[model samples]
Target: MTADLDQGSRTPLVSVLIPAFNHEGFVERCLDSVLEDPYPAKEIVIIDDGSTDHTAERIAQWVAAHGSEIPVEFVRRENRGIAATLNELAARSHGEFLRIGASDDYLLPGGLQAQVGYLLSHRNKGAVIGDSIVIDGEGNRLHDSGMCDLHGADKRLYDSSDGIRRAVIGHWAIGGPVTLLRKSVLETVARWTEGLRIDDWDMFLRLAARDAIGFIDVTVCAYRLHGANFSKTRHTATRIVNLTESREVAMSRVCLFDEPYRTLLRAQAQFIAAKIAFLQRRHTRVALHLATYASLLLLSKLRLHRTAHVHAEGA
Candidate 1:
């Protein structure tokens, strides 16, 4: 009983860093969800990134109402992008464990405590992430596992560290909000890469290279799938830019990997190019890029299989 009580008392502080944009109607729920989490030691650090709507106003109201209840550091700032806002929030946070989440999304009950505990026990992991429940704009349950429904990934792939790392360039099933990271690891990666709308991809790619990421088979967040969600926009130009940025980010990290993995990353870049070409109605370019992408991926797979077979025989 004494040891259990001591462990409970020693629960590390988790900084729930939220970057708020124009999520006026949803910011309060996001704040409330943090409070709802059963974690004993936690703080809220939120920055409104130049929201044109009443998001800042809602944040102000929530802080006013709940300031005395918890440690809250709230700021209303000019319109910088998400990456910039996340960097500022990370700098402001002073917690042993950090969770950077979207203001439009909410953390589930006990999620903070569970993730923190997982990291405490798993010394090999610098960051721990879990699945998220995908919900509609009206808060209706769309899918229990965002990894499966939204990310189009095999959920079981997240069961192992190697699986998650391989998926970094292949599937990208990790959710940004559900990840609980150590301050040291975030600092090691130098935090979010600014000047890119597709920022998290670059950061995670860096994390994967360092083998600093882990996963838990739990649903810890509500990933709201509203029309305005970053990856859901129908605007053709925005899609093109996002795809291009993704390719650039992947290409930048190829130096960290060797032969097969490097080829896989390059193949992913080519796949993204094919997507962009299709969007631009350059069917010929799409065909060419797709062919090269497929060929590179197949070669990588064959080499990987051969290596695995040799290792098995050696063993």
Candidate 2:
């Protein structure tokens, strides 16, 4: 376990912070993946966030069997939302780097090493997001690169902080469970906001504003696709609440930008509101939001294109 694999230096310990929910059938696989990872310097922190099912029991069972493999800290508590649970997990961790794991997902071979390496070399980056191998609930290979299916994300956008900001504002996909964050950077961004069912997008927006996030194309985790996945919620009311929350998060970041980017963020929020309106069958409101959204979106795109063209010519 070297700091730089190429240099055979010290390996920085990674705190794997996993906040679990009702994932009884899958939590063991998640723990197994963390254990299977070859990176030697590690600290595992798993919290079963008030799961109604036997998720906490399953986690307990796994810990009892394998806790001695490394430094493991397990906690089972009343259900708080994901964001609060994540914050608590980070607080309990002591690693230089942190990998936020989902109890329903598992990591890939060499994934942690690659992510750590990237952050070490790019000190300006707060976190590095890697790709995920998409799989079904049964562990059947659904395909590869879950981000592609989930976000249709452009790999190149990850190359520049500006591009990532654009992608986030433009509602482009930035996918995965393989994001490894520097503990300091997390502190820089003030940690995750509590009470939000959706957290990653908000956190990434803040990180990108500080030019702290980057993307790696390597597959780092097995992202299980089950019906219960938050993004795939079947209930209408739950979906609306999530959408409303996400829209608020996007809107909250609009003040951090200028010109086209500010407009882009607003447009994205407006687009989300349009979807919410459609869901509520508010046809007139939906039509109005859609028209405004389309115009703002198109205007931002044209301005952004012009800016990029000038930059490319070194103007």
Candidate 3:
């Protein structure tokens, strides 16, 4: 734990890493939310990922205006994707924990304090994620993400690999932007995969495999859903191909030690492929993928049944 000299208290430093890319309109508001936080021990690291707009300039102006009130570091670089930018930001961070901040999103009041306190007290947790409220481009509140509802009523701790796998595979209950992770976890896992579009999800799975994750039952941040959000491209052919390839890469790495997990991942991949093929109107390809999916599912169930029968006989 690092002590804050100004506050004369023991508080871990939380690094807010913002990867800005062409978000000229909302970047200032994002910075404002972080700077206004009551948490005394925090730093902001902003990396402008080759924004052609005035995003970098806006960041500079904000820093100039509030540099004395808060610690802010800004970096400008050529066009790299989110993964590369996140890697660079993580390397530059000096905090014990890292919070990823999208330029278009803003944290709710007391978010940092709540997350930091939870992580500091819970030594066994590798990361802490909270619920988020969805907002439109103009910052109008849409609705809660219902993450807390999905996770349960109270704060939950996921300690087992199976729990993590099921949480990720079954519903994807954790939100990346609303989560704060221990920096040591990243050190152990190396860093984000440089070129993968789903790098956040992949990293979360790896971290969960290594250590426990915590869920805080509160709305800690606001996620902006705008026209330019990356998820809007989900139905595109290029994005579908990328999603399939990325899932394969992630599953290959994590499923190496567990056959059941591998089988489940294979089934998921086939199901996704079937959906893509159906969208493309390839009837033959769709049928083949669906058949493969069903067969894999049945095989997985049989394996589970055999294991259960053996355990029952032993009992």
Candidate 4:
């Protein structure tokens, strides 16, 4: 009967932020999923990141056709990185919680509703993330789910009975669709690190450190794994460079000085980095990872510095 819901309401104002690049072929599917969401969203903000294709024009046509029935706002900007586009959208957002959806990805029906319910139940939890179904370029199911096992010295888990302090670091098994972050938590962290090649992991770690994360334990969205995707196009070296830089930045912001517990976290971070390095064929990083684990196992004081030595020698 009214536009604004009552206070203490379980219903949340969800702002779906879809940052589109040159995803003209797949952007429509993404928007359709959001618009068809069982739970009504307050707004759907799609930012065009300077696509050299017809993505913006198509989005414009959709906006004109749909109008206010589904609040779709389109903004055009010069080609900037995904991080910058997200930061800009974050600044312009007006929702209780924000869910970022890539133009290539789509939200499953009732996905947003389920997550909103969970976030309401767990008010203290600033985020709720779930697993996703992996799909191919032709919209064919590739995997039942995109969940990771994350086995290694750095393996991280979403739900741990051992408590947050005991959980492995840098190992939150979450995709962008799985996570719906409170605007407050995001505001505290400020905008994402613009121009950075990879900011999701860094941002997630920062948020997890400040507040405990809630896992939905369900596949709520479809994650598209395609050749034209960012990860596919970007060179392996670019990924390594960005990940290394972002990890350092995130660690600097985290407080790990008071406890031996930090040792576990450091070890986990090293393992995760090692996996990325392994993927990129950076054998030297893999060695540094093992050395870091060794230093931690020996309870050495110069754990990270010694690992740095390993990196230097390996290089």
Candidate 5:
């Protein structure tokens, strides 16, 4: 066990990584929340993902005005999307801990400080995620509380194969710019997947497989569920495509090869597919749930055969 140190000495150097797209309207509010964090050594890193609006201009102005008082760094990159932007920010950050915040989302007051305190107190943990308030586009709080995974609540730090298996099987370790992760764990795992839409889920499963994760019961962040959000604008099919692809990437690394694990994943994938189908109004496809589960059972019976066939077919 790692020895706990003094609060002054043990205050983990936290870098608040804010990846901004076309969030000109709410960027200031987001930054304000970060600035309000009571943590003394917090550093704010904002990466503008090629915003076509005045986002860059606004950040520049804020920097000029209060840059000296706050430890903030601003970078502008070509519109490479959120995954690439986050990876770039992680690459350049020097903090011992990283709390990724979306420009559309803001850390509730005391959010950063509280998370840092928890993570430092429990040294073996790799990440700490908490509930978040769901708000409308105008920052009006729609819901005071968020979701959690009852399965993961008992574990102080998640490691080992079984722990990872439970996490991957549709356990709701709610993520979306509402969690704090250790920079060292991220460095070891590398950056986010560039081609995936739900990169947070992928990253979480991978990290939890290797280390411990803590859950804070209180909501410490705000998740903006606006109409203009990426998930809302994109077609359901496109989102599902990304989700399916990302799930494959994660499963491949962890349990895609094992029989029981692969069955579990296929079942969960089918469940997600059904949910997306329902959301897309494809009622016919929603009935595919039973078929998907049946197919999984049949495939599991011939697991080795199917695995060989897939590999041989080069699919």
Candidate 6:
């Protein structure tokens, strides 16, 4: 669908997409956070993925209360997984930019302004990601996110063509909720990869492969950590396995220029596999994966050191 921008207006429209699945307790706060934002041109789209809780009712109540203030659309569908819900939302969205909101996470004030401004200024960038604060289930701030703590006020524009590939190969560098993506860039990549537990991660990698991700140093959102979170659930082993496999599949799709980059990605995947095998108490598999992990790590280090030495000699 086309974005709803007035003929006379130059301000780009943004679509805030929320896929709700059973987050009854915190959904209102999440919705309120976005609604309270001062962005002049924006819309909220909520899709209730067969929530068994009162999430649907809460969303309905929210719409009734604030529907007139902002354009809001609500839909209820069977329990399609996260990837499918996101794809459907993308199809219905009418925004030049898209913010994927989590039902349990809250956007901080000025989040849209910060991200949208960056994207507008850097037309070549496909997405802009800000930092986030990690909060507890009760909405109490826990700490700065890993990205914030690691970067510590460095606001650098990354050419994801190489930077993002290296970052993801080493670790998960982008915060999902704090990102605002150009709709056209997402369309070029065809959106989220379906049926993977870490489809968001996959999407990030694919989009980065196309070389279009930016970073903003400001904290633009709060990511709530709760027991119900998929990463914290009792099925940790299964989730870990899915994560490893997803990384493997995603890495296979990208063609890295250097063999070392490919090896690092393979090592990271095996590291996750080793963790899962250890968790499941599969001794034989764990031993094999651990050996592979160590060897790969050594090789990666050696390669990096050699590259550095060559650069130093050139300097």
* Model 2 bad stretches (over 4 Å): 1-4, 230-232, 305-315
What candidate 6 gets wrong by more than 4 Å, as runs, is 1-10, 146-163, 173-176, 230-234, 254-259, 297-315
lDDT of 1: 0.85
- Cα-based lDDT for every prediction: 0.85, 0.85, 0.77, 0.71, 0.72, 0.77
lDDT of 1 by residue, 126-241 (tens): 88888899888889999889898887988666666667777888887776488888988876778888898888889888887777887777788999888787555578988898
C-alpha RMSD of each candidate structure in angstroms: 2.9, 2.6, 4.5, 8.1, 7.3, 5.0
Model 6 / residue 114 / CA error / Å = 1.0
Model 2, 1-315: lDDT tens per residue?
112355565689999999999999999999999999998889899998899999999989888999889789999999889889999999999999999899999999899988888888887888888888888889999878676776687767767777888877775465547789999987678889987777888888888777788777888898888888745666788889989998999889888777678888889888899889998999999999989999998999888888889889995
Please give the lDDT score at residue 185 for candidate 5. 82
What's model 6's overall lDDT? 0.77
**TM-score, one value per model:** 0.93, 0.92, 0.84, 0.80, 0.78, 0.84
Please report, as a residue range, the 10-residue window in candidate 5 with the lowest summed lDDT: 149-158
| Candidate 3: residue 179 lDDT (0-100) | 87
Ranking by TM-score: 1, 2, 3, 6, 4, 5
Model 5: which residue pairs collide?
157-212, 158-212
lDDT of 3 at 154: 26
Q: Number of clashes in every candidate structure?
A: 0, 3, 0, 1, 2, 0
Task: List model 4 lDDT by residue over 1-315, tens digit each.
Answer: 002233556676888888999888888888888888778656888899999999998888888877668876789889988898988787777889988888888999877777777777777778777778888889998776676532121223455422333432434445546678788887666668776665776676566565546766667889887877636536776666766775575466447323344565666666657767887787998898888867774563465456658879999
Q: lDDT, candidate 2, residue 14?
A: 97
User: Candidate 3: which pairs clash?
Assistant: none
Better of 2 and 3 by TM-score: 2
Q: Candidates 1 and 3: which is better by lDDT?
A: 1
Instruction: Give the lowest summed-lDDT range of ten residues in model 3.
Output: 1-10
